[model samples]
Target: MITGELKNKIDALWDMFAAGGLVNPLEVIEQITYLMFIRDLDDTDNVRAKESVMLGIPYQSIGDYKERPNMIGMYKTALPKDVAEKMRELLQWYSKQEKNLTTLAEFHVRYEIIHPFQDGNGRTGRMILFREALKSADVDPFIIQDDNRSSYIEGLKEYREEQKTDKLVSLMQQETVDYYQQCSYFME
Candidate 1:
């Protein structure tokens, strides 16, 4: 039941996955489930909220010299020994910042850079995003699409290298609105 450009794109996707040793197609589905991250915002201290994202994970550090990769392997992560301090710094920074989209954007980028959790960094980081969205309006996850995928990465990189979060905040705000508009009708 598939053909044309869409099929081509799917084929390319399969090729990419195949190159990465992902033979089981179900793995793609599982990864997609992982992408369904983030949650609603609350007034409580979100520090623990983000920390609790990775249950049974360390608060201090993980290994003798652990360093995790970004989804795209953009740059190195915080040194293993520095994970605790870096996380503390990120939390302190988060506490002082406003509980809004901009702060959420920067906090997420910083959290990803820290790579606090041993294996669930993205899952945990994604949680912080939805919590903020939940605070103001309905939960609106970034709609999974080809464009959003690339834009999301660009937003992260912009934050990391240039220390600019405007692009990311804008993207999230728009994604919030788009997600609501596209999906809210089904709820009604």
Candidate 2:
């Protein structure tokens, strides 16, 4: 769970990116993910170092940075134009849909189609889907487990090719039902 302070930090980070002329929403997401990844790596390294000290073992930190030339240029070139506009349009359309699993599935598929970043699109889109589900539908978000990768990819491909959302919707619904059933069982 993101604490309010962390959320505020993230918002500040986003604002920093905007101030740095990253107006595209997809670029913003990608850049934010990069920053988050860096922070997580450092945090992981710190934890591992502490654990190693506790266990009296040598530890190699993951914070070894290799400077790459033209990285900024590469990123600038990688971000396509008008991503913010596209996202705004998508949000406007989504706001009209009934808040349900089906709508969530459709939103995820369309978000993939947008492909806003050079990488991390899938992870970011899934996060957005989960967040939206919890906020709009009042349900616990379901994970697309590793075992279901192929089916998930197939569903995405089918949607891209045929504009059909049934497979994805069914998959999401089943996952959600399974999650709730498990929760109920645990509660009982």
Candidate 3:
């Protein structure tokens, strides 16, 4: 259950995104994605730290500036030993980093393949990708609006599991570029 203060933070984040001139749904969703990941990791890290102290277990915060491998090791341990903590850490990192469109698309593909969260990962990943796209290029968010569920799932699966993000990245890049072109012409 989100406390009132946390809810207010989420609302404030949404408001900040809106005020940033992100008029497209994709932009809004993407911003939410980045913010959500940050919030999740920050909150989880704090909770886990408290648990560690209470249980007398050793725990390192992911944000600590240890070597990459050590940080990753700590991240892997972040998820409950009985749960999928590594995946959560991976997706959380993906949201915070600013990658190129190709990389961003590939990261999303890989992330979805892992399916870190128990739920809402696909939609959330897409939202994060769209939000980064908004920052990377001036365009509205694109939706997978077709009724063909197989195609959509397959598209993400190809990238996440099969290492086939080239096509997905290409597709998203083209769409963003096209949208920007349209916007530019309209403004002119």
Candidate 4:
């Protein structure tokens, strides 16, 4: 919740990125990585802004939220300006959705789109999705693994682009079946 003069300064920095046509998330990260390399090679290491304090929570903002401008393929995540409000809306909406595959997929999709955290958005969202699955009746929890990564991205892209969840729901269905089979095997 950075505000006042500090927020303005942060906004100015983002504006500079926009002015330089660095809208792509990967490009921005690349530029920042170079800056980090240069900083590592230099002796000017005492000038970091003291505003942010890391609390060892990957899914949360530090002292205040910062945007990393994340993207998945062509889809840019929620805008930096809308993070707080959108996150509020997401939580509110999350509290009321029907706890099933449709809602679960939709919830995961929306969370990925919102992408509130600077880092760990995907992992955090998947964790929440799995938890939500546990809460739902008859929906065995399953992790979104690297093996299903393409389908996961495709599902997200479909919903983001076309307002559809069939692919996502299908993926969840298969994952749950797999989870149940594994559980049965272990029990046997």
Candidate 5:
């Protein structure tokens, strides 16, 4: 069950994303992905800090975003050094982009590859994607039925292996276009 506090946090996050001027579903999701990554890192560091006597990693060893040029260092606290560097590069590349539909799509492609969340990454990413879609594209989020899960995962796999984003992007585009058309028809 969703607690009231958690519900409020989600609502507040959506509002913050909207205020940040990221209306594209992909852009919003990407922004949220970064924030979530930072939050998770802080949480993990807090846990590690309590056990610092054994881990030998001080809580204060965690890099502050204000001191660092990028968050690659923060995420590194949890990820392998090499993986963290790669994700940091991707995040920096994407974060510098201006808000646009193309950037939104690119964000979706890159963030999925980073896969920063230990769990709930896919679901949370999709939620941001949906909200951004509603705000920017006027498209409602469509559910991917259980049977289609394999295809979705396969598309993401191709992206990671080959850097090809066509399959997933096309699927999202088609779903959004289809939903918009259906809604338009109903209104007519």
Candidate 6:
């Protein structure tokens, strides 16, 4: 869970990107991920520096500065304008939906269709799914474990090929129920 301070920091970073004219959602997501990575790296470096001092070892910082390249241009050139426009439309539609499992499933499928990033689209989409579920639904968010990869893929394929969300919805619902049940058993 992101603490209030970290969430505020992320929101500020997001606002900075938006103010800098990043209108593309994918670019925003990527830039936020980069900012989060940098923040985490800085935190880790601080801990390591302390450890090194305690151990009487020289600390090698990972905080080597690098020039920030024109990633906007690169991302703009990589993602076609039409695709970005379509993603914007999809996001707008998503914003209007009542938050629920069905809407989440639809959003996931549509996001996959957009496939905004060169890689990590599926992972990013699932992250969004889990976040949305946690914020809006009555169920606990569940991870799609490695053992369930085949069924998950099949569910996605079913949605893509046949416009069916039943499989995916069922898979997610079952996972949520099973996770809560396991938690309950452990608590007992």
Among these predicted structures, which one has the highest TM-score?
4
Q: Alpha-carbon error at 164 in model 2, in Å?
A: 1.1
* Candidate 4: regions farther than 4 A off: 1-64
Estimate the overall C-alpha local distance difference test score of candidate 6.
Answer: 0.67
Question: Which is superior by lDDT, 3 or 4?
Answer: 4
Error of 2 at 134 (Å): 1.3
* RMSD list, candidates in order: 13.9, 13.8, 11.0, 18.9, 9.7, 13.7
**Candidate 3 weakest lDDT stretch, 10 residues:** 66-75
What is the alpha-carbon lDDT for the whole of candidate 5?
0.57
Per-candidate local distance difference test: 0.65, 0.66, 0.58, 0.71, 0.57, 0.67
- The better-scoring model by lDDT among 1 and 2 is 2
Clashes of each: 4, 0, 3, 0, 0, 0
lDDT (10s digit) by residue, model 2, range 1-188: 46699889967876898899987654554455457756765676688889999999866555222122112211221125555567788899998988887778888888777666544466667767656765663545665655787778877877777888889887787777765665453233
- Model 6, residue 89: distance off in Å is 1.0
Q: Once superposed on the true structure, which residue ranges of model 2 sit more than 4 Å away at CA?
A: 1-79, 138-140, 181-188
When 2 and 3 are scored with TM-score, the better candidate is 2
Can you give the lDDT of residue 70 in candidate 2? 19
TM accuracy, model 6: 0.55
Candidate 3 to truth, TM: 0.43
Estimate, for each residue in 1-188, the C-alpha lDDT of model 3 and write its tens digit. 56699889966866776798876655565555567767887787788889989999777675432222211211231233423555666668776865676667667766654444533455566766666555665434544333544555666656545667666755675565655664453243
Per-residue alpha-carbon lDDT of candidate 6 for residues 70-121, written as tens digits (9 for 90 to 100): 1221232123345567778989999998777888888887777666654345
Over 4 Å off in model 1, which ranges?
Answer: 1-72, 136-147
TM-score (all chains, Cα) for each model: 0.56, 0.55, 0.43, 0.63, 0.45, 0.55
Question: What is the alpha-carbon lDDT of model 3 when measured against the actual structure?
Answer: 0.58
